[model samples]
Structure formats: C-alpha cells, structure tokens
Target: MDALPDTLPDAPGERLRIASYNIRKCLGTDRRRNPERTMRVIKRTAAEIAVLQEADRRLGDRPAALTPEVIAQASDYTPLPIAKNHVSLGWHGNAILVRPWIELEDLHHLDLPSFEPRGAVAADLRRDGQLLRVVGVHLGLRTPDRLRQLGAISDWLATQTRLPTLILGDFNEWSATAPLAPLKPDFNVLAPGPSFHARLRLAPLDRIAHCDLWEPARTGMLDEGEALRASDHLPIWGEFRLPG
Candidate 1:
C-alpha cells in the first residue's frame, strides 16, 4: 500500500493534509461490513483532517457505522460531533475527523435542498495559530440538486469570516466543473484521480476544493491494501501549504 509522505520540505509555510472518502457505511466492495478495515484505509492516508461520506447507517436513528471505539483503537484522530442525534457520527452521513491537536472553534450542520435527506458539515479549526475552514458534503444524485446544494454552501460561506478554506467529500458528480460552478471563482477544484467503483477505478467522484490562501502541493488516490476493498470508493487526499 502506498502511504502519503509523512513530511514535506521545510518551506516557508505551514502544511496541512486533508482527505475525503466515501466509506459506503463501512460496507466494502467485497460485500462485507468491516469498520476496522475501513479505518485502516483512512489511516493510510495520514490526513490531518478527513471528510467522510456515509459514515452512518441511513435509517433507524442512523447509527454510526464507524464507532468511536474503533476509531480510537486504529488512529489518533477525533471525530467531530456533527451529528444531530446522539447515535450517529455525522449529519446526513457526512462527518469530519481531525487530529487531536487541532482546535475546533465553531461548526455548523447545513440542511440542503434535495429530494432526500442530504446535508453538509462545516468546521472552523485552528492549529499553530493558523485558522482554517473545512466543509464536508455528500451531495444528491441529481445534477440540479447538486448545483443547488453547492450554491447553498457558497451562500453560507459568504456570511462567515474568510479563512484558508477547503471543501471536500463525495460530490457524486461525474464532471468536476459544471456542478461545482458556485465555488469555481474563488476555489481551486481538484479531482485527484478516479476514485469511484474502487475495484475498477472509473470515475473521479471524490474531490477537494481550496481557496487561494493555500497552495496545492500534491493530491492522489489510495489504491493499495485495505483501501481497495474497504469501500466502493477509494479515499482521495490533498496536501496544501498555508503561507505564514
């Protein structure tokens, strides 16, 4: 399995590694539910912040698919309390996990306009005096709804104080540009690589977009070991350097 580099060149800025993954509720392509294996793939990314889709079951209180105990045992990251209910880990199956040292200043759970129960989560985090905004979303299947969801997110961000921001998750859009128009003018949208249908690797549905305050360093998909079978969609990651 290929792991992302542990450290980057000691340049003039602070660096951050962020990743997005659709864990399919911890149900892998092998038709098995193994949250441990799913977390193993996440650990491989070595992301300081991870935006995850389908982290909880869809029905009946929406219980978390990846329990806190499993996450604690496998990694050093802590899951944000973005879920509305006590049983779930995220809102509408979208969750954010950050390293223990990162300070969470604020958070919001957005209810998107869609035919189904779809939502997004946003967090303001501070590390080493650098304040960053991160949004995690899992959009609807239809293109029109996806556009509307992005617009809603854009509108929400417009109301907040600007920071080095990142929006990442399973966008569920085939073309990275069209549906993501609302964010294009200010954010650099990137589809690291084909991450869907993990076994075949045919679509670039998972993506990360960042504002100009940060410079993109590297991005790629995790394709080896548990990553290949832990979920139907492989994890995609991005490394960015925030100027001091």
Candidate 2:
C-alpha cells in the first residue's frame, strides 16, 4: 500500500490531517457497489480523521453501506457513534471516522431542519491531552435550506467551548466560498478543490470549516485513478498547524 503523508500531530499538541468524502453509497464509477474499492480510496487519504457522507442506503432499512467489519479490515479507523439501529449506519447519511488511537470523549447528533432528512454528527475527541470537536455534516441541496442548515450549525457551535472545532463533509454547495457569514470571525472555511463528479471534477461540493485555533497548512483533493473509480466524489484532506 502507498503511504500517505504524515497526518499525525507533529508534537504532543501540534497538528493533524482531517478529511471528508461523499462515498455515494459505495457505488463505483463502474456501476458496481464495491465496498472494497471505497475503503481503498479512504485508506489512500491517510487521514487521522475522516468525515463521510452517504454511508447508508437512502431508503429501506437504511442499512449501512460501509459496515464496521469492512472498515476494520480495510483501514486503521473506526466509526463514531452516529449509527442508532443495529443495521442502520449514520445519522441522515453523515458519519465520522477517527483513527484507532484518537481517544473519544463524547459523541452527539445535531438534527438540522431540512425539507429532506439531514443532520450532523459531533465528536468530542482527545489526542495527547488536546481536545478537539469534530462535526461531520451533509447539507441540503436547496440554497435556502443549506443556509438554514448552516445557521443551525452555527448556533449550536456558539455554545461549545472547544477552541479548535472542525466542521466537514459534503456541503452540496456549488460556490467557491461557503455562505457561512454568521460563522465568520470564528471559523475559517476551506474547499480543497472541485471534488464532485470525480470523472469531470466540476464542483467544490465538499468543504471543511474550522475555528481559529489552527490554520490549514495544506489542502487538496485525492483524484487518483483508483480514487476516481471508487466513488463519485473525490476525497479531500487538510493538514492544520497546532496553536502556539
């Protein structure tokens, strides 16, 4: 396996790499539902933390597309407490996965208002004594609804005391800038690149928003040939600098 760059914190309280991917229910460009291919692309990111969108079936029992067993065998990662039912996976198709060594402190679900089912997953994690809040989300398609969802997320973030909060996932927005004015002055939004439609690579639908505690050192989309065949959207990752 090709090793991704070091995504771990440089020192005890340094930095880490966080990534986001909309796996499209593990359906590959070849028109086959391949969990192995999806996990292969995820492993390629070499991210310490990964936020996933569309991790479950859209209808029916909403069974998990990426089962825990497969994830364990494919990568050194584990899913956050986003799944409720034994067979279900994630909250409204949003899920969070963290490295095995990242200590989890708490986990919660943020229900966002939408014409369709939409929500966010919040994970309070500790690494080397540093606490980090990670929120995985998949916003709505409509502009107005997306704005409202962003507002709901912003309001919830206001009550948290964590310094470095990371918000990431499939935003479903087609703009270059995230329309999160309310979160401004407190959060910095980053779009790695055009991540949607991996074949054409036309839109920046995936993004990461973070608090001021850390600045992203580098960010980009993983569009390898295997990755493009794994899912419809390419995985995006960011390396952040630890606060001094």
Candidate 3:
C-alpha cells in the first residue's frame, strides 16, 4: 500500500492517532486465551487512544481480559480509570486506553436505553495541553434499540461543551450513515472500511467518529493477517488533525 499524505493542507494541527478494537475477550480462532496477541495488535496501531470492546469475560465474575501488567509489558498505553464492578476491567465491557502522555481529567459511564445490557464510557482527557472528551460504546444489537441508544447519547453530548468529541466502539450495525443522524450536524461519522468478521470482513461493525473541531487527515482499517487471527473483528483507526 502507498503512503497517505503526511499532512493536510492549510493550517496544520496536532496529529492524534485514534483506534478502536473488539478483542472478543481475547479468545482467538484457536479457542485459546491470548492477551499478548491482542496487545500486539493494539501496539501495532501506534494509537494514542483506543476504545476497546469486550475487555472482560462475559460470565463468571467477568474478570478483566487485559491486566495492568500485561498492558505495561506490551505497550505504553494505560487504561483509563473507570468505576469498577465485579472485577471487570471496564464499565459494560467498554474500556478506553490512552498513551501515557494523555492525562485523564474525569470519567463516567452512560446508561444507554436498550432491551439488552448496553452502556458507554466517557472520559475527559488532556493531551498536549488540549482537552478532549472521548466516549467508548457498544450499542444494542436491535435496530430500534440502537436508534434510541444513539438518541440518549445525543442528549448526553448536548450537555458537553467540548469542541472535539470522539465516540468509538462496536456499534453492531451495518448502515453507519442512517444511524448517525442525531450527530450528523456536529460529528463526522467515518467509514474506515469493513472491520467485522475478521475472516470475511463483510460489514464495518467497528467504527470511530469525531466532532467538527478536528479534521480527518487519514482513515483506514487495520486488517493485517495477525490482526485477523487475534479476534473476530478487525481494528479501525483514524488520524485526525486537532485545531492548534
């Protein structure tokens, strides 16, 4: 693949590398637990911020899928401080990991309206003297529930005064354009390409979006051979130019 443009035209700004991945609880196709392999995929992205889905076991106490020592041994990324419940790594299996340079100001979980158990984790982070709010979510599987969950998220975003807000995770939906109507006015929903079913990659289930405060420089899917084996869904990443 050819290299993309290194920089965007006009006013230059801080380049932020953002990524989103669904690790499938670190269980690969081989039917084995491999946190190291999952961490390797995340490290390969070189992302400053990555919102992870399924960072914990689904049953039996729901222990953390990725631990602090494992994260430290694999890369420089640190998981944000989220309210812990039942030894899980994150709230509702949605976790936000950031590079050491990114400092967390505040964190909370949003209870999304859903027929099933669904939620979002929001983090106020400061990077290079710039404040940004990041929301990591996993929407409900049903269409109607997803729409209502998005509406609830929109109501929450309205309360936030932050300019450059990012929402990333496994949306579990195929039609990205229609579902994002609530945020279309302010956020730019990007289709980095199909990221789900790593082997087939027929649908773009995992995605990332940002408010107009930042401009997208480059966006694409991280579908390496190793990434495909790590989980059922491939990771998607985007490089954004934050206003200076």
Candidate 4:
C-alpha cells in the first residue's frame, strides 16, 4: 500500500508507520533463524515502531538470555526483553523499537497464562503534542493460549483512556477465526496480510491492528531490496488518519 504517513494524526495528532514480523528467532524458516537476516527485514521497514516475535536467546527447556551485545550486532533499535517462559528461560520474547524521532516511556511486559510466558509491551510517546500508547505483543502459539492472553490484554487496554493505541505482532492467524473474535470489537486489524514463509511468500503469519484509526487507509508488505535479506518473514505495514 502507500507509505505509512511520515506521521500518524489521530486526535491531538501523531504520525508513525508501525509494523510486525515473526523473525523466526532471527533464523529463516528454511534453517537457523539468522540474526543478520532478521535485522535486515527490520531496518528496511523504516517504521517508527515494530513488534517482533521469535527472537531467541535460547529455545526449548534451555532458554538463553538475549544480551545487549547480540541486539547491537543486528539492529539500530534498542532491544527490551518483555517476557520469559515459566522456567525463567528467556529464550524467546517480544521485541520493541521506536524510531529516533519518537520518544517512548512507560515500557512494561504483561504476564499472561500459558505453557509459555506471553506478554504485551506498551509505551507512551508523543508526536506534535498528541500522546499515544503503543503496544508490541506476541501471543501464545495455541488457540486457548492466545484466547487467555487476549483476555488479560483486553482488560488492560480497556483502561487506556483517550490516547490512540497500537497492537502489532505475529498473531499466528490465517482467517477471521479466533484472533478477531476477542479483539475486533475494540481494535482494527490492517488487512491483506500473509507474512510468513518468506521464500514461499504467504502473509498469514504477520499482522498490524489498531484502536482509534480513522479510515484504516492502507495495508502492505515490504519486500524490496535489503528487506528481502532481513528474514524469512516479510514486514507488514499500514497507515491511519483521524476521522473528520
């Protein structure tokens, strides 16, 4: 779709391009989710904020910690560890990034019920005086798991008050089934997504949804040049304007 507005203007009025991608732990689905490839997809998006799924420090029972040194090697965005599984093994967790112009504050991770430690990372930022809440999330892989996770998410989101908010991630959704069921009443999912299995190129694996967007103006994937080198999954992006 069209480039996300250099700025997103809601009430008060801030502009930003937001995106989501499942980096497959920085390894391409083809093999070892390569961190180099993962970072490539990220830099190409030129988004103000991003939510990444499957970034790994370690996986399975032996969760590894993602060090600052690891993130610095691949991306320009600061990496924040938002959730870890029950054993405290932090192998995989949500990743959040804000562009240089956007200032972020109040970063926190949500602890949801699941075999995995699922979370929602949120921050407050300003663009020309319009304040907004932005969230980066990666829900559980199982249906019941996501359902439970969203419940806690909804409860917290209900308290957001007037600022426009964003929720982006690897929702693991293909059809309107479960994902839409719980969060649709409160938010809008940017359309025409197929973000996984990059070499094959299907978008079911990635998505961007929002609350308080006026017309839901555009939706698309970034797959050109350096973006292709980023990861197995493509980056999905969108734009929103205030209702007149």
Candidate 4, residue 7: lDDT:
32
- Model 1 stretches with alpha carbons more than 4 Å out: 1-3, 6-13, 176-179
- What overall lDDT goes with each candidate model? 0.87, 0.84, 0.81, 0.62
* Whole-model lDDT, model 3: 0.81
> In what order do the candidates fall by TM-score, top score first?
1, 2, 3, 4
> What would the TM-scores of all predictions be?
0.94, 0.93, 0.92, 0.77
lDDT of 3 by residue, 105-186 (tens): 8887899998988899989888888888889989889988887887888889898776578888898888755547766677
Q: Which one is best on TM-score? A: 1
Per-residue lDDT tens digits for candidate 4, residues 74-115, read: 655655344445432122366675554566656666677788
lDDT of 4: 0.62
Name the lDDT of candidate 1: 0.87
| Worst-scoring 10-residue span by lDDT in model 1 | 5-14
Flag clash pairs in model 2. none
Q: Tens-digit lDDT track for model 1 on 24-43?
A: 99999889999999988887
After TM-score superposition, what is the CA distance of residue 7 in candidate 4 from its true location, in Å?
16
